[model samples]
Target: MAKRIVLFMFMTFTSLVLSGCLVAESKYLKKAEEADALGREAATLQEMHRELSAENGTLKAQLSRVKEEAAVLAKEKEKLSADNRELDQVLRSKTDSLSQTVADLRQKVSDLEDENARLKEEIAAAQKAREENVRQVSKTYEDLLDSMKGEIAQGQVTISELKGKLTVNMVDAILFDSGEAEVKQGGMDVLAKMVDILKGVQDKMIRIEGHTDNVRIIGNLARRFPTNWELSAARAINVARYLQSRGIDPAVLAAVANSEYRPVATNDTGEGRAKNRRIEIVLVPRDAP
Candidate 1:
């Protein structure tokens, strides 16, 4: 009996020890399961952190690219502003030039208009003076024609008006003897009458033109008057001096000698020679120059 009881106690002790070991084993298994679950959760959190870090890097790169593009846009905007200012300045300069050109053109037009007005006034004044001169000359011619009617009818003098010139032609026989430069009594009377009529005309210039027939001077007359030219010149000068002595202004008198060159008719006949030997009084306008 004692041996059996010892064996039973030993068995009971072994069983109790075994039960404690089994319980400890079960707790260890539960702790290991919890640790495994924690490990899985940590791995999941690490994966999420890596994804977030990569997303942050992508966002940083996008921000860098955006900053670069913004810098380029700012530079372009500044350049465009500068170009606009330059263009505005150019436009203003051109506008100023155009305004000046227009002003100059206006001044030129004004000057031309003034010049045109002055020219028109000058033309009108000139025309008026010319008309007055024409009327005065015409009246003088008609008065001369009437005054010398008797001499004209006798063929001793001829009065003619042409192109504003008045000419009184007197035959040499009525004024002087043959081959003589001195005036006869009849010539003196004719010259005195002409002087009386001519004294009234202050505006016209009087010219005495002496003409000679184509006859050579001879004898004592040749000594007094060498050639026809000398005889004609002496005759014209004497006539002009007589006119001056008879109240005619010397300023209005001119003496000319035409020797045998100017002839009114053929000098081959005696009657034609008589016609060619004559004294001519010419009335010319004062403004003939």
Candidate 2:
């Protein structure tokens, strides 16, 4: 019985020890399973974090591109605004210049009108002076004609009064020898008195005219003179020169010869021939006093 009890105790101790070892092995297995599950979960979380980080980097690049585009648009808008302002300034300057030009044109037109009025006044004054000059010239000629008429009526010389002009006839019998251009002493005295009368009239033009009969000159006198026309011309020129020497303006004297061309009476009679050979003096009114 003592041997059996000892064997029984040894088996019991073996069984208890085996039981504790088995429990410990089970606990270790459970802990290993929990650790494996936790490790798988951690690996999944790491993959998800890597993917999120890559997505965030892509979104940040897109935002940067959008901000660059916005900045370019803002610069373009500023440039357009500056161009519009310059155009507006140019338009305003052109409008002001046009207004000033229009005002200057109006002033020039007004000045031209004033100048035209002054020219009109000057022309009117000149016309008035011309009219007054004509009136004075007419009165002076009429007075001289009347005085000459009175002298002719007193039997000193023969004269005829005509419309707007006068005529004087100096007969050759009273003034010159037959077929001669020389004037007698008495004829010279008469001519001198007429010269004095003509000198009193200022600014008068005087004409001395000589005439001849149809009778021809003969001998050396004919060769020297050629014709009665030449003799008559010489006589008229001599009378004109005498008048010029007697203080008459040379501009006022004219000489002409009419050789038996113009006659007041027929050349058939001796008395008519004598009347044809004569000298005449005419006075004309001048434009200036």
Candidate 3:
């Protein structure tokens, strides 16, 4: 609207200048009034020009403020973009760390499960071994008890079963005469029967242990025997040799002596002393050694 007014005023001023050139004398009749009117119009034009100039200045100032605000907004947008990029990087790093932690925890749980399974298998194997050992021992004890029934009833032998071992307890009088290390004929018969049963048992160890009463040797018997320890050892060795000669495996046999140290009865009485002098044939697992 301001531009149109300015253009209209400029065209009117040009027309007035041209008319003055052509009709300088034709306007003589109301020249004063006309001149006065022209003066008023010029004054109005000047006022409008001043007002337009002031408004142009105000618009210039407003344009400068708008440019400054736009520059500031551009800088703020750049800052926000940079902050978003940094936040994205941080979030990605945190996600990777959490994923790695989860993987490690899963591996730990797997290892623990594997270990638990291994322990269970070991426990099962141990239980099986114990059961097998018990079965073997029970079978050996039953055979010994059945075969030695007559001797047991006559008080010559006793059979005992405990743990994983079988023990056949025989009185010294059943194997040897007084002051003798050689086994009697009756003892050989008993040993022959025992050997028949033992040869069938392949996974057992046989040990012959001899025990003697605390009695000092005297006379020719003393010269032949020497000491109680020697007598006891000789008796055990003799029993082991006899068993080996009777087809019992020598690899499964061992001999040992206990001179008055492992007595089953008191030496204060004759009956007790006789009971204390004894022999033990032990059957144990082959792995027991």
Candidate 4:
């Protein structure tokens, strides 16, 4: 446009010069120069406008790309926020479960400790009671041993103590004669001394056990006694009856018969057979069944 305006102005000035208009030539030349200057200024302004338009277009494109990148960054930020919230919830639930488990374990450990303490106390009390019982039993054994020293020396009686019980073993010959179950005079004398000692015992049950040799019964003895079982039972009953008549408590007495099965020695020799035929008097706790 500036070039076209400049060309039209130059053609008008050339026509004026050809028509011989010398008075207007100076004015036309000045107008022509002014028009040329205006044309050059317009061309410069147009070039600046073109450059400004190009720069504006580039800026618009750069702004559009920046907007797209901002949208992507916003979406990523939202996603990361949601993920963080989920992670926090999971961590809280796990912590709560773990705390409950730890509390339950601590309660169980406390209950076990209480049970262990109770058991320890019971064990200590029982140990103390047993010690007292042992001391009492030892004293009783010493007294009986001293009282029966003479009979023990003559081999007519044997005394022993075990656990919390006292035992007095007597040969059957001194109490009976040739399968007889009745107590002899000498046996009564011996029993009188033992009964005196046993009567003083408290909380003790006196048990009389009758034992016999392995000899089988025959002839006159068989007719009266039958087997050793009946003989031993009869002997034990007679002894218990005798003790009851001599101031010993009938309620505390128990008579048991052993028919050669519970022998102290082998029954193959005379001395062994003699030893096998005996009576055992045991004193035990009244509560023992």
Candidate 5:
């Protein structure tokens, strides 16, 4: 019985020791699992920290680019402002020069206007002097026409003095044919004598005045003459042309026509109608006061 108790006690002690070792192993396994979980958590934290650092670096790079862009924009703005100031200065200088030029031009225009008025006044004075000289010379011209009165009467040419002027009336029968502008052969001698008398007059203006009776012209000859007025005008022009061809100055000659307007006598009478168709050569001073 004692030997049995001894074996049993030994078995009981072995069981107790085995139970303590199991408890220690269980505690060690729990500590190992906690360590493994801590390691995983630390690895997760490290990954998160790396990602944050990379994002921070990217943000820093973006900020640096933004600062560089801002600096470039600022420099461009300054350059533009400087250019605008320079342009404004140039515009001001040009405006001042233009204003000065306009002022000078206005002064010049005023001076030119004054000079023009002075020149006009001087011209008027000179013209007045010339007219006075012509008036004095006109009396001598009239005296010469009076001296040829006897010769003019013999040639069937009548002379009359009116308003200090002489009028020579030559009939169409003595000067031209019917509806014709040609001067007759006998009229040539009379005109030559008159021209000779007028040659002595200084600054003489000669006018050849023509007149015609009222007659409607028709046919080829009438087409050339057109009307009595045209015929009279042509006759006067022809006489003036003849005088010019005979060495008379063109400046001294003037020709005109009057158709049945300046009749000294009545047109109802044939003799008065004949008298109405006439040519007159008038000698006058070029200018008169």
Candidate 6:
């Protein structure tokens, strides 16, 4: 359009110049310059519009990609929420189990404490009973020792107390004849004194242990007592029977024989043989079974 306007103006100026109607050259040149300037401005406006349209297309593409990335991020967030919920359920289950286990451990600890207390009480009771038993045995030992001081001084008897057991040793000559198992009058009197001292004994067993010297049975005596074992056994039994008859508790009585064994002295000499042929009265704890 600007070119057409410039062409029409040029023709009009030529017609005027040919008819002798002259126009100013400055005005005509100024109109041509103004037309060229308008054309240049129009071209610049169209180029700017094209560049703007391309930039708008690029911005639209970028917006579409940004929206797609936002959708993917939303899906990931939903999946993460589901996974977190599952983890929470598992954690709660484990926590509940741990709580119950801790409670059971606490209960077991309380039960053990109760059991420990019960054991302590039982041990205390047992200790008290043991102390009472010791006192009872000590009194019995002192009383027997005082009452038999004369026999103890003459070496006819020896009294000993060891590890809660009390023992009284008497020679065979004081309790029996040369080859007899019978208790004589003097022996009965000595046993009567022992029975009096031992009457108040509690929770104890009184055992009569008879020992014989290392002498073989021979002559007429061999017929009835074939060996020292038989003779010693018979003598122990007789002494136990006599003590039972003298107000001692028969339930606490036991008889044992040591024939030429468990001797306190050797049987080679006459004095040692006399010491070996002795009876022992022992106070001991009762067997359970």
The most accurate candidate by TM-score is: 6
Give the candidate number with the greatest lDDT. 6
Q: Against the hidden reference, what TM-scores do the models get?
A: 0.62, 0.47, 0.61, 0.62, 0.48, 0.68
Alpha-carbon deviation at 100 in model 2, angstroms = 28
> What tens digits encode model 6's per-residue C-alpha lDDT throughout 1-289?
9999999999988887865634566677889999999999999999999999999999999999999999999999999999999999999999999999999999999999999999999999978978888888898888998998988889899999887889999999988989999999999988988888777888889999989999899999999899999999999999999998888889999999889988889889999899999999999988622
lDDT per residue (tens digit) for residues 91-147 in model 2 = 889889888988998898898889889888988986775455444445545554455
Question: By the lDDT metric, which is better: model 1 or model 5?
Answer: 1
Each prediction's total of clashing residue pairs, residues at least 3 apart in sequence or on different chains, is 0, 0, 0, 0, 0, 0
lDDT (tens digit, per residue) of candidate 3 on 1-289: 9999999998988889888866866667469789899999999999999999999999999999998999899999899999999999998999999899999999999999999899999989978977887886787778878888999999999998888778999999999988899999988988877888888775788999999999887899888778888888999999999999988889999999888898898999999999989999998877886
Ranking, lDDT, top scorer first = 6, 3, 4, 1, 5, 2
lDDT for each residue of candidate 1 in 84-180, tens digit (9 for 90 to 100)? 9999999899999989999999999999999999999998997886677567667666777677778888999998878778889999888889888
lDDT of each candidate versus the true structure: 0.87, 0.73, 0.89, 0.88, 0.78, 0.90
- CA RMSD, predictions in order: 8.0, 12.5, 12.8, 9.6, 13.1, 8.2
Q: Which stretches of candidate 4 lie over 4 Å from their true place?
A: 1-121, 286-289
Question: For model 5, what is the error of residue 248's alpha carbon versus the real structure, in angstroms, after optimal superposition?
Answer: 1.6
Off by over 4 Å in 3: 1-112
The residue-level lDDT of candidate 6 at 155 comes to: 88
Model 1: lDDT of residue 34: 92
- State the TM-score for model 2: 0.47
- Residue pairs in steric clash, candidate 6? none
lDDT (Cα) of model 3: 0.89
For candidate 1, the TM-score is 0.62
Where does candidate 5 stray beyond 4 Å?
1-151
Candidate 5 local distance difference test against the native: 0.78
